[model samples]
Target chain A: MLEDKNPQKTKLEQLGEFGLIKHLTKDFALQQKSTIKGIGDDAAVLDFKDNKAVVSTDLLIEGVHFDLSYMPLKHLGYKAVMVNLSDIYAMNATATQITVSIAVSNRFPLEAIEEFYSGVALAAEIYKVDLVGGDTTTSTKGMLISITAIGEAKDEELAYRNGAKPNDLLVVTGDLGAAYCGLQVLEREKEVFKVNPNSQPDLSEYTYVVERQLKPEARRDIKELLKSLEVQPTSMIDISDGLSSEILHLCEESQVGCNLYEDKIPLDPTVIAACEEFNIDSTLVALSGGEDYELLFTIDQKDFLKIKGNPNLTVIGHMTDKNEGAHLVARNNSKIPITAQGWNSFS
Target chain B: MLEDKNPQKTKLEQLGEFGLIKHLTKDFALQQKSTIKGIGDDAAVLDFKDNKAVVSTDLLIEGVHFDLSYMPLKHLGYKAVMVNLSDIYAMNATATQITVSIAVSNRFPLEAIEEFYSGVALAAEIYKVDLVGGDTTTSTKGMLISITAIGEAKDEELAYRNGAKPNDLLVVTGDLGAAYCGLQVLEREKEVFKVNPNSQPDLSEYTYVVERQLKPEARRDIKELLKSLEVQPTSMIDISDGLSSEILHLCEESQVGCNLYEDKIPLDPTVIAACEEFNIDSTLVALSGGEDYELLFTIDQKDFLKIKGNPNLTVIGHMTDKNEGAHLVARNNSKIPITAQGWNSFS
Candidate 1:
């Protein structure tokens, strides 16, 4: 939440554009050798040499993508960077640089922006990515953030969403539904606080889910893990718009159908508990809950044994022929159509 | 100016995210040989091989950057892409691809977005750049556009802001103050329309300035022009934040002073006429008015004869020793300190 951490609020207008940007990015040091130039230039220069470069961009708007009342600016900044990096990881590349652009209104003070940038700086330090270039300006209302992540990978190692083939073993890393359940918990607490401003609800029990919602990390290590195991994914994508929506994206792009087993959809105990307490179906929650920041990939059946017993990876489904259509094989032996009932920004 | 061109308004929610993106970008054909993959992927893949890559991003918020009351959505879209490409060109690189991200409120119909994208498609085609990737999301208030442009250049050809030295001839491409004057005209018409909705002000007399504002083009040909004449800029930057601000940036980065001649600051006849009509000082307008989108660079004095008397290129100033300080030499022989009185978005 936007709790005032500093008593002295510095007006953004007083600092001016150049002054503000200089103050915010003064501490960020370039960590990547590929970054030929960082800030203080018309454009950031990079030399990727022989490595193929990968790029992904995401735009986040206040009220639509986040609520500052329940989301801390630091966590929001960190999550925004994570979201873009997740895409690069999904492409089986090593993220090396990022450009962050933000537009905020007068309602936000210089300290508030600094807080956001500090979070961004922390993510950059942890991920070993250089902050290359960005644009900062004023918005008429609310806040908006756009991040473009740059990565590098060899030609043969790169993965694409359209590379899946029939009979490939569909796999997902970590667990699903926690982030969505965490959002539910935060929303519930926000409603409670709205009714009684003085009431302080204990959020200790929902720690895992809340953390998943606010401070989720991208699966940056999965590529290295797969390489070490000598397993190359045929196709891969990140779980951002829930399992159903992402699965559909892979199926449609690859021109194949999938048979996702409901029983195989991994769920943490905390997520299962939250779903039960909230009176929602766990399978539906797992399928429709978004923002897991996990990797979903398809591996050739011959390479399945390398990841078969790995605790972090789970074989959730198998790619099928196009005529089979995309379906969910329920635990009760009933087949149900898989639809993109995930988070839709338009809705 | 956000005028209703289509009676049929299709809600963006109907098509969803994937459908909306597919429908809007279906007409875009990848023209850049470096682009290995485009949209419909976790990330766009590019292969620049040995060429160094340059990246620059810009964020434009409606109401803050443009007043839709007189600015058409198509022009805004085109201008947005141009703004990012201008930065790439400032680095003396060839723009190869772009990723555009937009956050729009529900008030906008799908057709309006299509209109905007058509302009973007036109710019991409004209510039010979590929629309590689982007993100579309909902905004709580007005629209916000963020574009990241990717460019490539040989190492020896790249120019940076810190390359200038004492005695370098300061050169600028094309005229100045036109875009800023154009904005003043648009704002005036908008105010006039607000008072009397039926009034139609004739903008034919302000064609050059109006076109400079609405359909501004990034100087994509300037790099080739310099190359043809065997000239390389010692330092370069685009004029987005007025001549004074950019001159200051060049001076500070290059650790040099400048003697900018007031009489030599290029101003078109239309700009001069508008200044006379508006009763504003033409010199101040050219120096402090922003959004010219012209290339300003410093070249070795030895190359002066090659660019001398060229209609497109103007030698306005020369870099001086750092102790001399950056100054403007007036027509009356009085010297004045050049300060950044450019457009401040924060203010």
Candidate 2:
């Protein structure tokens, strides 16, 4: 539906693999002091002297994690990097380098790959992460992107999911459910375009939510913001798989149950409106809708006052004893056991 | 043709993505002192104090990189790891950890993934590298494997492609072209099996060549061997691409040239026999056939005596001034310009 007519199509075979990689990455200058070597070599060398290196990898497959019909290649590339970097930020690390490998089918032209790399370059430039090493190859069917994000942190500054204690306040950065609501708007627009090709999508009302989905930024500021507030999260995880699921992960990993208040869940106005228009419950959307890319964390009660009124932060819940189990206390004052409604690839 | 008709198949949907990852990697214990945290978190943490970390990544797509019709899931998993680790070894670094991410369609049973992970486990155990982090997801088509290897080395120990100078003696570890010949044998056998499924063709004669393709190992010993000999290579690269292409890369990056002697190119007797049977020139196979995973390097001429007559090493060529250009001195004393005939995914 989004196919461009008379698009300049340069066959990928013209450049081959090495030529394509060089052409795409030639402009990326090494900015990080930790990067001793970036690209060109068989491996990229990084010197994180006396610091802890955090590494995370994620794979995005076409028709599974994304659809090209709606996802622009640039946005796809940008989102792919964001997904991996979110993990690094979740560890309270400063993302320093990333390696992006992509496998494309013959259907894509060289220009398409250039657009994708442009997005990657933009992300690396903005995030201050060096594009170190990657492999480019061909897939039999569709495009597949695998990204590994590497970051650095001091030993004492890192946080893990297993550190939360009972009575700790659960906090989340930014509002939830906007990205999911944005996807709904896009899917509806896609359906409309399929029925009538000439129909143009009017996404003005969904600007915030759609941007949240298409160009979501990793919570790179959270680490600094928390530090400025003199608040250190006892446990942290990125909200990629919805709030309830992530809360459960923190609870299970830390061996402490959580009382997630449904009323306290933050939702953007656009998300609330979209949910109402789609006839879906906003609270349920916040609970199960994912791709928020927000930081979900817990801090000691003593530090709660330091961040109580922060515009970007919301106190959503509190930790409980392991025997209490993870539950969502609804506005109606009834407890609902939280289950993993996260997206399951196999299912 | 190699399908197991009555094999038990466990549906993957029974275990979601996280469950599958946990089940597959449950046995992988952290062996590297640099590894601060392995799996189960958002990211893996490593403390590479005062050492430079080398990182490399590779993606293997089904049908493009391997034909599962003959390639077992186990070998594919093992080979994927080897391909990435080879890059680390090429950098003269000790491989310390790897992150393996995979996307498989529902066509593969849970048992198939288990089989693949078993091979990964074996590689990790044998290589003494920790399995740090990975993401498990579903693809729309066939299986896809992406691995990122992380290693470390002292500042001066790492070798790069841009260090070869004029008069440096070119060297290679182990025999070449065997893996390419092995692929040919496997392909021929696959065609034969298509004609007669019940014919149990004995592969004893093709054992060496076939194993070279199916279960190739990265040259992890070459670094230690060179250290023991007190011979340091000025430049090095792994033979993922053909020898000619790798040599060209070294020459181009180092601003030098080389004259690779055809007669000195190491090839196993089995490879020569296979080349003869296939009616392909042994020289061309050794020059352009890739996936050898051997270390190709250049050492200063002064260090030749240290590696002279070593069984594991072969002096195949010598670096020349950049104005001389790269060429192959054929057996009859004819110098032919080298070209890249390495595997091109787009082609």
Candidate 3:
């Protein structure tokens, strides 16, 4: 349904590579002071001066990461930027610049690529990050996107996963499992459309969940929120590969154990409703359903009162000694070991 | 012939995503003091202190960038890193770190991925750059590689393409067109192999060209070479897309024209012989054939004596007024306008 029916399809080869890149990125003005040179060079020059730089990258393949049957090109481009930015944010740094490289097949027209870059421009504008440099080339098959995000922070202000200590309060931001549930809703609708192309199904009930999956935002506000509250996380990570998997990473890196309260796991109303309709356990969805783009962290016990009753922050659990091992405390008063059941592309 | 015929092949699914990355990069020791944190984290932390950072990225698709039938995974990995580093060196910066991400199909076993990483490790070791971070995931079809190289330099030490003056002399490092000629020899051998699978073709005569294509090196030594000689380039770029194309880039960026001497263009003896055997003009190959990874720059006329008669350097041309236009002064003394006949993947 999102595919363009316009007859004025501009072939990518007509303009060649240099012309295409110039045309696509002409309007991307540099916003950051650190970007000494943006684009139009062999490499971008960044002046971070006294601040430490954080770098993260990700590769998104068309068929493996997204299905164009339901996902739009604009959303894919926006999500690709978000995926890289989430890592920079997890480091408690301010994202200053990003480089986006894409390899696409000839099947896509120049207009289609423009649609994708429109979303990227929107993200860069909203996030206040400069587009530094990138490469554009043609692939043999489907589309491939690779993004590298660079951020900066003071050495003392940076957070690492190995800093969490015993008795630290585990915290989470916003809600979880919504993005995964949204994917499920989209997949089901795709099946329905496949059977009857003319069917007009009502999707009002899934608006929240569907939008969450299509245009999820990285938590760029939490850093400022914590600073205002005078609370610093001892350890932090983004929930991209699900809560359980990320929690395990924190535990392993910090050499500590965690007791996560099953009842305390945050879930949006739409996600709960979709879980009941889909006949799947909401807890399972919250634990193993990845791509939430929310921050999960641990703060000192002394900072617990500072964040108490904040709608955006939730006190989910606490850290324990290494010998206790990581576990999930059930509502029935039983404990179960937490394992990595997150999405594995290889599997 | 390069494909492994071993009986035992470990599936990539056996290690999963995180396990695979950890296994591949476990031996990569942190070499740069600027790299505060490398791998195993949400983002790699770099402390550039008072220096400016330079960043460049590239994406390589299997069928478009290489053919696995002739290109081994190790050389592909090594060459992918070189492509990005060439851009860093083009800026006259010291490369410090790199992040590599790849997406491959299930057809590649764990051993094949290991072979690729071995090449990456070797490049990092020789170049003294840290393997800071990367992402590994499964693709739906063939393989895809994306690399981002980070470098550091003082503000005054950096070279840009837009710094040339009217009287600056254009210079090139090493010889040109060998890599492109190497590709031609390899293609011919592939055709020969197709005609007779049992043929044991002798490639000794084509060794120099073939190795130039497969194992080309970025001129990391050029920065130090220029510094030692006290001759900084006024404008610089890597010769990846042919000398004519790169010269045009310098002219466009610096708002100047160029007059290239056909007789002054450097060509190795092996490249000249290969050109003759293939019945192609050596000048055309040196002008349009790319992937040389040699440094091309313009220096002030006063610094000409410092590099004169240097075996590694060749004064090929000189900058002129923008109205003069870019041209190649052929051996016959005819002026021909230079255009970009460089590789465009879309075409």
Model 1, clash count?
A: 1
What lDDT tens digits, residue by residue, belong to model 1 across residues A1-347? 34434557888889899888899999999999999999888899999999999999999998888889988999999999999999999999999999999998878988889989989999999999999989889998888999999999999999999999999999999999999999999999989988999998898999999999999999999999999999999999999999999999999999999999999999999999999999999988889899999999999999988998999999999999989999999999899999988788898
Taking the tens digit of each residue's C-alpha lDDT, what string does model 3 give over B30-51? 9999999999989999999999
Q: Give the per-residue lDDT of model 3 (tens digit) for A232-292.
A: 8999999999999999999999999999999999999889999999999999999999999
Q: Global CA lDDT of candidate 3, please?
A: 0.92
Give the alpha carbon lDDT tens digit for every residue of B1-347 in model 2. Answer: 22334356777788988788889999998999999999988999999998999999999998889999889888888888999999999999999999999998877888888889988988898888999999899998888999999999998999999999999999999999999998998898889999998888788999998888999999999999999999878999999989989999999999999999999999899999999999999989888889999999999999999999999999999999999999999989999999988877788
Question: Ten-residue segment with the worst summed lDDT in candidate 2 chain B?
Answer: B1-10
TM-score of 2: 0.98
Instruction: Let me know the DockQ for model 2.
Output: 0.93
| Candidate 1 lDDT tens digits, B164-243 | 99999999999999998998898898889889999989999999999998999999999999999999999999999899
DockQ order, best first, reads: 2, 3, 1
The residue pairs that clash in candidate 3, if any, are: none
Please provide TM-scores computed only on chain A for all of the candidate models, following their numbering: 0.98, 0.98, 0.98
Docking class of 3: high
